[model samples]
Target: MSTRTDEVERYEHLWQEPAYPHRWVLWDTAGDVLVFDRETNCLVDFDDESVLPDVLGRMRAAGVPESGDYPGRPCA
Candidate 1:
């Protein structure tokens, strides 16, 4: 199993300026959801099935769109 830090590092290279000021939501190659925060320079991997809705809720609250059709579907 990959650690959260490991997962963040794995996807760091794909980071770009977000459409919103401080937060961006995306999915990994394996269709796992991830959220990146510019203010904290932190990446959150939502690997837990139960916490996905809450994670998305927080992201939406942070200004990320609540649409399933994000810019890149499978942001690897």
Candidate 2:
């Protein structure tokens, strides 16, 4: 597992529920992405970084950074 990687998938079923609950399966592998179905709760491993470009593009288009943390931010 690489420390430079991050993965997140929103639980579809919980996404529509009244409570804002999220079931997250995080990965720290440089070339692995997971796609899990909320209904079945099965793990599907996709050892490819190709899909991340599209995902990052979407996030960039939405005016959000591909990543949230700013570890380099200087303390004020």
Candidate 3:
């Protein structure tokens, strides 16, 4: 049986691949951006504009396209 750590490792490996599936971006009411990884049920919140470039870089590394704007449902 796989432990939780093993599952997490698997997800991490998957995330390193190009065009990893089920990854999405969401905007909060406050206008911050959040990266949602469906496979891992993880949310990476970007609360500062200064970190946007870094965030975008990470997104690209994860095979998600970079866009000036992302259309999606707002987070409550």
Could you give candidate 3's per-residue lDDT for residues 1-76 as a string of tens digits?
9654443443343345546344564334345445554444556543344555455455557666433354344545
**What does candidate 1's lDDT look like per residue over 1-76, in tens digits?**
8665564344443343465443555434346565644444455544454555555554455456433333332434
How well does candidate 2 score on lDDT at residue 27?
28
Q: Model 2: per-residue lDDT, tens digit, 1-76?
A: 5332343232222223333222322222455433332234554344555545444343334443122222122435
Task: Please list the Cα RMSD from the true structure of every candidate, rounded to 1 decimal place.
Answer: 9.2, 12.6, 8.5
- 1 versus 2: better TM-score goes to: 1
* lDDT (Cα) of model 3: 0.48
What would the TM-score be for candidate 1 when compared with the true structure?
A: 0.35
For candidate 3, the 10 contiguous residues with the lowest summed lDDT are: 6-15
Return whichever of 1 and 2 wins on lDDT: 1
Question: Whose TM-score is higher: candidate 1's or candidate 3's?
Answer: 1
TM-score for model 3? Answer: 0.34
- Weakest lDDT window of 10 consecutive positions for candidate 2: 64-73
lDDT score, candidate 1, position 57: 51
